[model samples]
Target: MIETIVLDIGETITRDDRYWASWADWLSVPRHTLSALVGAVVARGLDNAEALRLMRPGIDVAAEYRAREAAGRGEYLDDSDLHEDVRPALAALRAAGARVVIAGNQTVRAGELLRGLGLPADLVVTSGEWGVAKPHPEFFQRVLEVAQAPARATVYVGDHPANDVFPARAAGLRVAHLRRGPWGHLWAGDPEVVAAADWCIDSLMELRTIVGG
Candidate 1:
């Protein structure tokens, strides 16, 4: 009965408004330009990393992100970066006897950041630790192994339809699409994608109704 709840880190649990603005400031690009870049990538169904590389070929995106985290500057979200609804929703799930965890394509430092934020997660796993990314069978297999949950009894919540919704569903897990961030807002117009999700919610709080308690 929905014993395990898997959540995406970026956009799903953490809001990115301030984060993106910070990135724009760091790169000396106008906020609108950054937004346009993201939009262009999403529209072309291209990876964001590819878009960044095309925009500035020599820059190392991963290293830049690491530097930002180290310097305490630009788009690095901490405990304060969490959306208001995250805590209460997660707390409710835990109280309902559910094992909630963070599963996403984050860096090695993600576990420390999530823990420091005091997020209500039993575990925080990343692509780094699992040696694979989302939409891959191995990634979901790792998640299932860690949660020790059968597909039918688990629900995955995330903002991206491709990385979060489709893949988790393909793994036989119920999916909840939280329409808040770039991917969510951009893909919201696709009726087929929207309807495919077991639950399309505007807030994390709605998870309570979808899962239980």
Candidate 2:
């Protein structure tokens, strides 16, 4: 029986549209242009780590864009309507005695996002707060310590193959891949890592079947 359900917030629970849309006004460039630039950077042989470093400068621009957008529109990015069944699905897991925790890499702003969306999570673990990010076993270790649950009894659900599944598996937890729209295709292309996961599902709502809701 799965005693705990750990989740990644951004792409796993919330859709990617909100993130991309938030960037549209921030960079003062078209969203497609930014996406193309990201592809270009990756195509130029920059590894994911390097591309992230290169993109760090754009964070300030994004912040300004978000501020302006908020002022003009009076609304922040919309977390795609929570999956219709997510709330009840999560409640079912909890009813089955599973502890739910959210482990993610975010600035201190994560709490606001979680509370803002009214997502149900028993604990929120963040790299910004811990000084370490996913794919690093230490991040999971810290969460394990806090959750006080055995790794074997926990299942981590996330979107990224490397950052989510692999590291959690290394830490001895079952992993569920949240294979949503486009990003799902990107992850599926990675045969080796995708194979590492115990199960993959198209949505959070499907997790109950995987872990026996």
Which candidate number would show the highest TM-score if scored against the true structure? 1
* Ten residues in sequence with the least summed lDDT for candidate 2: 45-54
The Cα error of candidate 1 at residue 22, in Å, is 3.8
Candidate 2 lDDT over 1-213, as tens digits, reads: 677888876666655555555455454567776565555654453433333335455445446545765676423434453555567777777666778887777655654556576566677667878889887889999868766678887888887776787888989988887776344446665776567787887767777776674
- TM-score of each candidate structure, all chains considered together: 0.89, 0.78
Q: Enumerate residue pairs that collide in model 2.
A: 26-65
| Inter-residue clash pairs, candidate 1 | none
lDDT at 159 for candidate 2? 73
**Per-residue lDDT of 4 in model 1:** 88
